[model samples]
Target: MDGPPPLPLREQKMNSEEKSFLLPKGPSRLPVSGLRLKRPASDENEPPKVDRKRARGPLDPTKRGGPVTAAPCFPKPPPAAPGLRSHRQAAGSRRTVAAAAPKPAAAPAAAGGGEKKRAPWDLKGQVSDLRAKVGIYKEKAQGLAGENEALRQRLNQLEGELKQATARNQQLEGQNSALALELQTCQAQATESLQRVEQLVEQEQQLQETIKSQSQTIRELESAGRKAREAKEDLAAQLEAREAELRLAQESLAQRAQENEALAARKAQLEQKLHESEMERRSLHNAVQELKGNIRVFCRVRPLLSSEKEAQKPGMSHLRFPPDDSKSLVLSKAEESHVGRERKEDIVYEFNFDQVFPPSSSQEEVFEEISLLVQSALDGYHVCIFAYGQTGSGKTYTMEGPDCQDPSTAGMIPRAVQQIFRKAREMEAKGWKYHFTANFLEIYNESLRDLLVLRPERGSELEIRRVSQCTEELHVPNLCYVPVASEHEVLKLLQRAKANRSVAKTNLNERSSRSHSLFQLRIEGHNANRELHTSSVLSLVDLAGSERLDKSLSTGDRLKETQAINSSLSNLGLVITALSNKEAHVPYRNSKLTYLLQNSLGGNSKMLMFVNISPSEENFAESLNSLRFARKVNECVIGTASNRK
Candidate 1:
């Protein structure tokens, strides 16, 4: 029987369900099953056929075209009952038979127009074919089940990988952002570095220019240094030549020095000869003064006083200086004649002295005459010079100047002091040194007093004593003997003595010296080169005014002072007169003044007396008395004085 009239051609092919059972799944499905289905060799060249709808299932919006998740497994159908199974099998058989059968076609067969023919039916053949197909389907189904199990395992693995990949991707994204920020920072740093590089490049360029200029300067300096070195060499050569010339000059100087030394020796010899000549001259001069007489006298006539001139008193008409004789003074006094009518007769007296000074004579001119005698004292001769005169006769003014400070008015004492000191200094060049000791004393009321003492104690009398029993030299005990270094020192002593000496007002003179003042300088000299030494004393005496008591308007103390002064004066005159007559016993101890001057008045001494006479006519008799006493002193010839050396 024809199997259900041949099925249509469309029905004869495999259905969609069967095709799906045979096809592979989409790309999302894993082929986890080890079993692979191989296509028939005849289909190798053909493209694979897939169902579009199943390949692109419902997609998740969030996932886009990503993988799809595994589907859930469905429960398998249970085995059918035997009879049903057989019936299903027969149906499937019938389908397969129909599919295997060729399509019916209208052919030239069947000459009978339109007579349909039915093929012969084979039941066993159909059953066999259906069983084989059923077996193939069972095998495919089992493989698909196994593939699904494997696919489930593979899907779990892929899901774990996907999660890991997603975490890694997020981490990479964070790192990328960090790296981008770092890139931005690095870019900013690079920009700053480029700017710094530009500034450094500018500095380097400037430094290069400076180096170039310095290099040129160094080259110029080197050239200058070479020139300076050459100049230094030339200077060195010139210095050497100068040194040679200096050596030659030094040699010449040495020769000249030798010649100068010879000249100096000659000069020394000449100076020695000069010193010898000076000594001879001093000796000759001393001999001359001795011949003139050791005891000498000088007469000085006092100038008329201003009071006499103002009162229109009788002028010094009685006193006259010889017109041609400097050594003589003529005194003429007009006396009344008793027999005639008031006719006055002239009594003329002429006195001669060693030197007579007129009113016009200067102190200097007077000192000049005695300066040589003063020098004799330095030659070891004891010298005594005294001024003897009546009151107000300029006796003090002659011995000591009215103003000792005035060189023009300075008298014999100051002028002699100056000359002594000056000569001492000059003699120092001759290897002579002189030491002087000075003492000033006054005889008041016939009592010895030390004028150099600042304040003399009341009733303290100084006594004259012999310096040694073997010598006639006399000195006053407790007298202040000062060592004098210069003339100024001696002058100061003179001033001090002048202040301390006794002075009193008298009718004859307002400020009459009431005491005899004596200044004595002891000179000791040494000449080392000549091995000579000399010691001598220079005595200067200013005798008290010798005015008669009646003329002096004496009373009480004044009368006593006048008597004492007159006694001392008379004693001095007696001593001179005795010496003149060559009396064996001289009255030296009769008064303090005479005894103290023992050595100076001896034969081994030089003596000078200044007889000062007043020019006033009222004092003519007193002047005459002083002149007579001085003449006696002048006439006495002491023996030749010898030097102490």
Candidate 2:
């Protein structure tokens, strides 16, 4: 039989494309012998059908003028049969038939002129159509070949995976059985766990109740604590108030006590002044009021010396002070006292003064009495204070004192200078400026010498000149008047002058001052508020101790010093006597001491005398003499003291 007729070019192209599309995209790894044609679903048990449509587009050499291209053939694969061996047999038979179809294509080329001769265009179209089909089939084959290689690898991998899945399924089946048993056990345990959870929830509710109760109790405690703290704060405030009141009361009491003490002291001072006024009117001459300006006399008794204490006779007291009057003192001998034995009074020698200080009185007590006069000097009143006594009678001690270490016993000179400097500072608020000059001099052997200056020799002469008659004040020429600002500087100057003083050891004293030392402080002040200037002089004199020639037992220089001392003291007595007698011509020129003190004694100056005496039986006669002299001084009337403002 002849082969089926060749298909038209368009129909052949459509059939070729259909065959390509229907064929599996991937090729089988097996040879074409293992391939099978697909069977119709309606014919399940029958062999696969021969697909002539796929075989229709064979290469026809007689139909093309040019070189002929062979048509690509694609066999449809059948469904997989139950047995791969029987299916592979059937595929091998079909492969043989397909291989024979291309033989007929070669027969047409050999037919020569007997084949239908196609036109050049028709041949070219058929050839071109065959070429296009060949190209499409080639592209599909290449793609399928690549896909086949990938599919082969995927198939191998899938086979291994399937084996693993099978084993896994078996394992899972076993695991599921075990899991079902575990689930049953877990359900039993979950029931027990739920019961425990229920118990824990109940315990939690009880714990929350306990926390609530504890919180309520804590709140109550906190409220009570707050109240207690407030009460404590109130008590503390009250305690502070009470303590403040007590402190104020204590301060008030102390202030009142101080006021009482001040009042009592003032009363005593007034009483003393009243008594002095009475005495001044009674004994100071008929010109009592006028004589008030005279030098005030105060007598101080020195304590008994050690030697006198040893020599004192038993049952004898030489010094006597009147019980009722502190201004009068009496000296009596033991032999003359007949109060108990003879019923006759003793030869009592009574002397009176402005003030009499006992030996027991302190330096401060003596200073308090003279402090007012020193203040007057700062007030522009010229003041003179002199200490007079026999040897070892404490005249120097009263004026310069024993020591400056103790302020209570520092003596009048230091205390007076200190007061001036202090008052000057205090008065600065009142616009007062003060200038103070200190001049220390001594009258030795009736000659004046600068005690503050350093001398090459003990007997060096010093310059002394009288001021002009027009000037009432006496000025010592070339006197070393040192400027002193503070009490310390004044003390230093006083110490230096004292070291330079003429002193000698005698039978009477260990260190007896042989010359009369005069320490003068002149003050000048300007008051800016009042537009006034003031000038004042404060003279502190330590007279040489008076002594008898026989008692002193002096020969050469000592004798001369004793006579000079006696002469000056006598001149001083005469000046007082003349003033007491109110004479027109007072013998101030009788001695250098008298002449130098003329203004201070009888002129416009405030003068004070301190008669120092020994409270010893052996010196009873000298003590009596000193008291008598002090009596004369007390009675003298100089002139009214004036302020140089």
Candidate 3:
């Protein structure tokens, strides 16, 4: 078969930039139909040229336009140039290549007698030497030509700029000389003016001195003439008055001596009585200090319905300090006050831990307003917010919202937990960090069960342990404290507990808390400034709703449970009543509710009570009793230290 024709340079330019080892295009890339050759057109058939360049893969820009001629192509590729092939096999492979891809249809290279001639371009042994010398000379010529052009352009620009600079410099120099002359002339004029001013000041000083000497001489003559008239008038009056005054002086001395003796006696009597009265006052003050408890009392009220008469909205029975009367709340001796019946919502009055309500109109809404007090606890104070409300009066809703995620309907517990974690995070300067350990327990079925605890059959019998923030002590018999970091974690815990809570569909709360559930959070941390541990106990307790036997269809097991819930709540009221009166006996041990809150109701704690009241007409009596019990609680004073007023 004949070798392929030489490819045209025009086709090579099309794929010049692609990286190819030899060539990317095939031998047929040329205009095959327009093939120009020595053969006649009559021979319409000839073996087609195989373009081996197709297998070259890609092209390289560096290997662009160069001489190309077909070489012999065998089943195998041509042998490498000269040193690239071995001596024994080089001649045979070269012969095969020249025959396989003949340079062109050049009359078969005029077939020599024995062997075909090789094309001049295929004489690699001769072209290599010529290519190396040509490359070096070409690079040198390009670099010199670039430098020559840059120098010519730079010279022309510099000459033009130099002429313009010279002209500008002359103009600036002329302006500077004129300014320097003006400065010199101004200095001379200032010096002359200064000399004239000094001369005028000296002449004025001389003239003023001459006038002052003349005025002094005239004043001295006037004083001498006035002294002569004064001497004659003084001599006449002095002689007559001296004789009469001597006689009266002797009588007055005798009367003054008697009066002095009487005054001294009266002064001694007043001093003796003053000292006795002071001693009595001090003794009483000391006794009062010993008896009185400085408990902080804050009044919190819930909103009333807009349609109700203003006077009945809060039920006048819940008022501690009259709502419309600000002066009464500010009074040093305000004993009783009126409740605001102004249009609002369900009314609740929260007071101190040791306050009592007589159930009049001034009842305490203990759970309704505790966010403010709990917020203060996060600010580094031991705070306790307890609910004192009848069952079914929204107590559970007040402390721990049944719907915890909703802030508007939030009860005390979720609100308290949210505030504590928030304040702890905000205490940046105190290097304050608070670890919250949550323990949800309920005094239910008269037995303590961890609400977060798995049912006995569902899981192992987990222990309920009490944790002590002091001395890092933890663990309680029925309550286990779980450390929580965020509000979301608390909410999830609440939701889980609510699901696990022993709820019965009662006439009151459909999912009423059957037992006293204590959601206790133990807050302990160090103050950023003092670096000392500050600890507080926070409890959001939801007492089971109070139910009327007549209205409730509860029986059997339900009745017993209701009885247990009521008995414990009653004991709670007694405990508050005893504390309010400063009674030596606080019945904390009377019930589980009171016993659990013993520390909170006593010393150094900021205790607030929310008496949750449901304005529903059906629950009014229980609400009224609840308010009266709350009012009694308002009178009790719990002892505390370090309250930020």
Candidate 4:
């Protein structure tokens, strides 16, 4: 062992301790290890005398110094590293020897060994042991590095998974946003649809009400239309019925025309036979020439009444007569006065027939003496039947006959119609169509008025007046005569004329005509083939009764009427007397009475007179005057006679 050839660990341990003793601890270790270590102590905490860097690193656990910096766990004298001596080998030889000198001989050899000889062996063993420990630390550091790498990989994978989860959350949020929008839109649409539905429901209800009203109205209209159609059908049926009646009338007209033709043919044949007979009968010509016209005259013979019966009979008979609706009348003193005076009279027969003839007369008799005169008129002759007598002589009766206002007597007017109709039927065709127009007029104070158109309330206003034919100022104004077909119609006219007459009672006669009444029938007849176009004028004159002013105690309107009557009667007598003598100055225009009698008194007219007289001696002078006037009228030779066979 020759002084233990310098042990490597012991040598270093010795050198290091000596150097650390020589120098201070500093940045040398850190600079060598390439670490920028933290400063061990702050500047203010270190002792002023001490080197701060050296003191801080040597004692601090945070900053190791010298050999400790490189190997912190290396024992200063690491006890006995593994199986080797601890301090003896690692420590310097100088330190080892010095330290052994102080130790006991026996203990020092067993633990530390001899300083120079044992150091080599101890150094070898400690070096080996430190190498083994360093190898163990390297293994631990490798394990830690592996664990760090594994943790880093795990962190990267977890971060990647978290990013994907974040992206998924964002996508889910987007989907939720879209779904919410769609839901909102759908909800809005549904709301709108619901509102629309509500509106539709309301409209439907309104339509239903309207339809109900319309249906009801339509029903009513249909009913009305049906009714109208039914009415139209009824009207059509009525029209058809009227049309049928018209057709029937046409057929009847045709049949009547045929019958008329047959009658006309028969009449023509009869006329031919008569003409032939006339040719064969030349010997009868002288007889016919001598007879020119057949003058057949009829006269009436009335029974005489005593003076007592005559004066009282008018009152009793008038009282017995029926009341009349046509006229409001009363019996005047003149109506009660007969031709006979109170005790005695001159005229013999009572002749008023107004109370005897009104309604109907026999067709055969027609009248007592007037049928012949009517027949003459029909034969194209002018015939005038004049009534000339005392005041109560029934002059109206003999001319036109009386109305139904007198209940006892049927009038000559009715009889006249019956006779005319009978003769018309017999004559058939002499071209004898008679258009008869009747005019009833009256003359009062030489003035003329229509009698049938009198005011009903005023008897005085109903006075008659005479009218001139060719006068500029007309008096019988606005008088129209209607065609009368039957006897009944003429009778009605007579009644109406009488009802409207004005009568003023005088002592001379009861119911004296205050005015002259004239019923003129202007007949238009065509009969030239049978020698008869005779437009004849038939005048039925009812004169105002003639009376002696001495007998009639006339007063007021009655006196004026009496004067007019006297004047007219005087004029009438003068005209008749003049015509009897064939005088040129006939004085026909002197008064209305004479003017009206122009044709009847003188012209081509045949006249008849009716005389009613009293048997009593008191009326003798008046009766004689009337008779003499009548006789003068009869003697008038106005013209040659025109009569019919």
Candidate 5:
């Protein structure tokens, strides 16, 4: 029932312009035709054909009028004239509807309001209005046609732009899909990077711990290095101090060395003077002994044995020693006189000697008196000491010591050997060197035998012979001359000789040396500093005891042994007596004992004799004979002793 509202002014103006463009400005050029009026179709049975053009007045809906009937109010034209008539009819009908339909409704309302209405059948005026209306409608149709054209063009342009937008939107959608995928990939990479970052953080922590420990170790090493440097400096300072002290010590040592050299030189000079003085003193001492007499005799009275003591022997009271004199002894015995009266008389025989040892004297005291004479042998003098007495009188004990010799009771032979060896060592300081050789021999039954030989050849007799024609020195041809180095060696030799010496049991004594035993030590000395050499012999003799055949009750071999011993002893006494009288010719070769002692009894030799006496009345005669012979020997002055240098 309502029409669309009018367009805006800009649209209306456009429409007007379109109308002006579309419609001719001038009047129509065609010949004017008369309006042909036709009857309205009264066919109710057939519907009227509507003029669709007039019903749809403009192509634009906004300009269209109300619905119009297809009722032919205009003329039906011939077929040949279809176009013109149709156009006219369409226009006329549209106008009628436009003008008539509203008028009727208005007419009713007007009538009610008492208003005048135009009658429906005013033909002429209606025609004129319709004509004018037709013209207006035609113009509007033309405008609408133009508007439709313009609208179509605009729609085409918009469709083209929409297609472009659609294509662009599709392209943008594809780009968005790629970006989404890239975003997914980026998210995955970021997640992986986050995980890697976590691992790196853990490694960084471990590295930090390592760095911390290394730093601690470095600090410790630095501390140690600093201490080492300080210690090195201390050591350097100590070394410097030590070097200084060493230098000072070296200087002091040099000074001390020089002083020691000078002292050594002074000591050498003093030692030389001392040696010279010692040599001179030895010369003087020997000279004093020479003046004392070369031949000296000592008397020793043996103590009564245990057997004699138990028996209370009468001879024990017969022997006597002077109270105030150590050099004199007396023998007092009661004797029956047959010529004058039948009464017992006390006969006193007194004797004097160089020295007399009483029964109380020790072997040490006896050796002390003979030690000086023994030393004279080392001083290049020939020295002889012998012990002579009857059987059981201690002659062998005094000369060679007891069978079981003790150091305290060692005889003259062992003591003399020890003294010679000791003095030889002491003389080494004075540049004297001595070599010693020893021989032990015995005169058995007028034959010379080597006591040192354990087993002698049957016919190998020892003979006393001169060493050479140029000198009077004597030696036994077959005697064993043992080179001895020490006193111990000589003592061993003495023991061996003692074991081999001749011994026998006789009526006068159980153990009596049946042969004369002689031990001789030959000393050869050299003084290299003084360019001097000397040779000497020391002869120690233990003579066989002289026993009376009647007293001993000896027969056979014992009687011969006794006779030989007595004869040699008697010759020994004769030689001493001749030397005491200063006879021109001394009978030194009468017996083996005398012949072997030739050099020792001469002027160039020193001699000592020991008369060992038994303090027993049974041996009174033999003891007196020994004492008298020793006294004769003591009184003899052979000569001043000389050294064989």
Candidate 6:
């Protein structure tokens, strides 16, 4: 009642603010015990009921880290308006009357004992106090009611908002789930894009490598093309050169063909002229041989011998070569026709022949006269050239020569052989071939010995048989016909024949051949172009020396040799006589010499007789006998020569 000492200004201001302010009580105003702070028309001991159905609110920043505290309590609930505040004021007035009842007594007693004094009873003051208190509590209660109402409204609003918020959260969560799925798809796409980028990078590298290899191949192809182009150029150059050479060869071939054609025409013309000339010459040759007689005789005079030179003749020489003609020989005799006659008056003898060789005439000059007859053998005519004279009258020398050393002195046989060889070789170009056979034999005492045989014994049996009687050409059976190719071969054969010839020492001659040596040449030729064959013979004979038995002073074997020689010579003379007379039976069988020459003497053959004569005065008788025989032979005509083909 003495009003609690006047409140502090700060406290008064806080109370006034509490009364005036509408905000609710905070935790700071709550009692420390279990009781809550009081309010107008509200119970103090009952705690303020919180609506547990309310949702939790946001945290308070002011209460951070503070002790746990409940919401502050306030008076009971009232009407939402100020009516609830009047009721609480009436209740507070009743409580004020009851408190005034004890205040007077306690005040007096305390005054007597000097206790605290009581307030003066002023209605305005008491009412003011009580009113003030009620007002404060009423305001507090109102504020509390207002706060509760606000809180309830807020909770209800929060509940509705929270329901809406929860729905929104659910919608947001669903949206988030969809967004996360989309994000995962985006991430996968991004990852895939990265992988693709890596693959692209690898492909680019491979493309780069491919481009590099292609560049290298392009380089190789370019190089090959260059080489091929160079090779083509070289081949083109070679083709051009070969073309030029072919052109040159064609021109040369054309030229050669033209020349050959011209030459062939000229050859044909010359051959025709030659054929006509050969025919004319052959006819003329035949007529000449006919006029001269088939057996033509030639006389050769020997030069002065050594004995004649030692004993010179006092008068003019008996032998003289004619001044008017070379074919005539004149011999003058100082004595009469008979020996030791007084009426000498210089007997004169003149001889004419086909040819007459003078004492000084060379072998060539003599061969020139007889070479034609030798040539007739090659022309297919059987020809005979016989040396018929006494032993020392140069018969062997004229036929075979002194020796073969001097070519100019080579006789008729050697010259004829050389000519035959030359002609045969020349004819080869004209398509003619010749086979030549040579045989040399000697008739000694009517026995034939082959001169060409390698060796001969003293008593060898050599047979000489005649060819068939039906054949005209004389052939000796078993006679060796050695084939000869050259002039030297013929000369060799002649040497062999000479070595084998029968010779003896006689009074009139130191070495006289005691046998008739016959060298036979058989020529068989064919003209390949004409296909005509021809056969002929050339019989070259060197007869033995014709000697008088008394003049030679022979006896014993020498006499027998002389008799045989004389007998063959006499038979040859008889055969000649019979041929000259054109008798039906010419004595060809009378002697071996005549028999051997049967075909050459009287048949279709040309016979040339060389009558060699000595110029020595001591051999006048033998010379006269040879001259007379030559004259007889010159007059004889055996037959017309015919070539055998």
Candidate 1 residue spans exceeding 4 A from truth: 1-268, 311-315, 339-344, 456-460
**Per-residue CA lDDT of candidate 5, range 537-622, in tens?**
99999989888787999999998999999999999989988987889988998998999889888888988888888887777787
User: Worst ten-residue run, lDDT, model 3?
Assistant: 24-33
For lDDT, the strongest prediction is 1
Write candidate 6's Cα lDDT for 381-446 as tens digits.
889898988878888888888854688888788889998899788667445799998999999888
How are the candidates ranked when ordered by lDDT, highest leading? Answer: 1, 5, 2, 6, 3, 4
lDDT for each residue of candidate 4 in 345-438, tens digit (9 for 90 to 100) = 2223322221122222222333643554665555544555555556765556555554445433555555656677677654442234676777
Show pairs that collide, candidate 6: none
Candidate 6 stretches greater than 4 Å from native: 1-292, 314-316, 335-344, 454-466
Error of 1 at 319 (Å): 1.5
Taken over the whole model, the C-alpha lDDT of each candidate is 0.70, 0.67, 0.50, 0.49, 0.69, 0.66
Q: For residues 1-645, could you state the per-residue lDDT of candidate 3 as single tens digits?
A: 267743322232112212111322112101112333243443334444332221111223123223233332224344344343334243543443233221233322221112222233433312322232233223323332333343344345434534543454454456456655755665565566556446645766676765565446435434533443343245335423332332322322332334334334433433333333323332332232223333433323344444434536345343445443321221111233356444344445333333222223221133323444565455445556655555555556556664536666565566667767776775542245677788887787556677886676334433433355453233456355678999889988888787777877786665666787777777777544444565667666667877768777789988988888888888877876777677898787667677767756665555665566655444556656665665576566665434321
- Model 4 regions more than 4 Å off: 1-269, 274-307, 310-366, 397-408, 429-431, 456-477, 528-532, 641-645
Superposed by TM-score, candidate 2 places the C-alpha of residue 463 at a distance from the truth, in angstroms, of 4.2
- Report the lDDT of model 6 for residue 63: 30
Candidate with more favorable, higher lDDT: 5 or 6: 5
Question: Distance (Å) between predicted and true CA of 364, model 6?
Answer: 1.6
Candidate 2 segments whose C-alpha is farther than 4 A from its true place: 1-293, 314-316, 334-345, 457-460
> Higher lDDT: candidate 2 or 3?
2
The root-mean-square deviation over C-alpha atoms between each candidate and the true structure, in angstroms, is 75.2, 65.8, 48.4, 79.3, 80.7, 79.4
Give the clash count for each candidate.
Answer: 0, 2, 70, 32, 3, 0
lDDT of 1 by residue, 305-380 (tens): 7887775456567888767667788998888887868867799998988889889888888888888789898888
The TM-score of candidate 3 is: 0.43
Over the full model, what C-alpha lDDT does candidate 3 score relative to the true structure?
0.50
